[model samples]
Target: MTDIETRIEQIAQVIGQFDDAQVPRNIRTSSKEAVEQWLLNKNKEMDLRLGMTASIMDEIFNDSNLPIHFGPMCLQVQTVLETLLNEVRGS
Candidate 1:
């Protein structure tokens, strides 16, 4: 598989580890907001090819009422996204 596809699969694996009751409500909201903000900032620097990826991420992060169990997965996804963003920024 391609690198992006591989990363997306890895993220799905991480997300599959949790259930809806494991995360706290507050954490879910915070994580979503954090990811949304990060994506917004990164969107400015992303190439056209990555725009669809960013839009998908934005859709995921835009949900303010995601299950509490999703918090950890969100953080993991955030880490992966941050790494990707940093790469895009050449940091």
Candidate 2:
């Protein structure tokens, strides 16, 4: 991955460990922002995944009558990420 992506992941990981037990305002808010950005990226990734899944599912379904489809993981992640992004942006 690129340097910027690596840094963002690192920052997100640090945010994962953050708790509001310390400074409940400034540091907490910073950590929250880090997490929100990470979630937004995940949401973008999920869009890509959903498109791929749809194409693959179309091919597979046409080839076989068996029931097969992508799980709801991508949709679930997207929903969570969107909610988090909205919350962050609203803040």
Off by over 4 Å in 2: 38-91
Candidate 2 C-alpha lDDT tens digits along 52-90 = 333332332244332223223223333444444344455
Q: Candidate 1: lDDT of 43?
A: 45
lDDT of 1: 0.49
Cα lDDT of model 1 by residue, 1-91, tens digit: 7565466455544544432455555544443443344333444444332344344444555566655555455555666765765675673
CA lDDT, candidate 2, residue 18? 37
C-alpha TM-scores of all predictions: 0.40, 0.29
* RMSD value for candidate 2: 16.4
What is the TM-score of candidate 2? 0.29
lDDT of each: 0.49, 0.40
Which one is best on lDDT? 1
Best by TM-score: 1
Task: List pairs with backbone clashes in candidate 2.
Answer: none
Query: Which 10 consecutive positions of candidate 2 have the poorest summed lDDT?
Result: 65-74
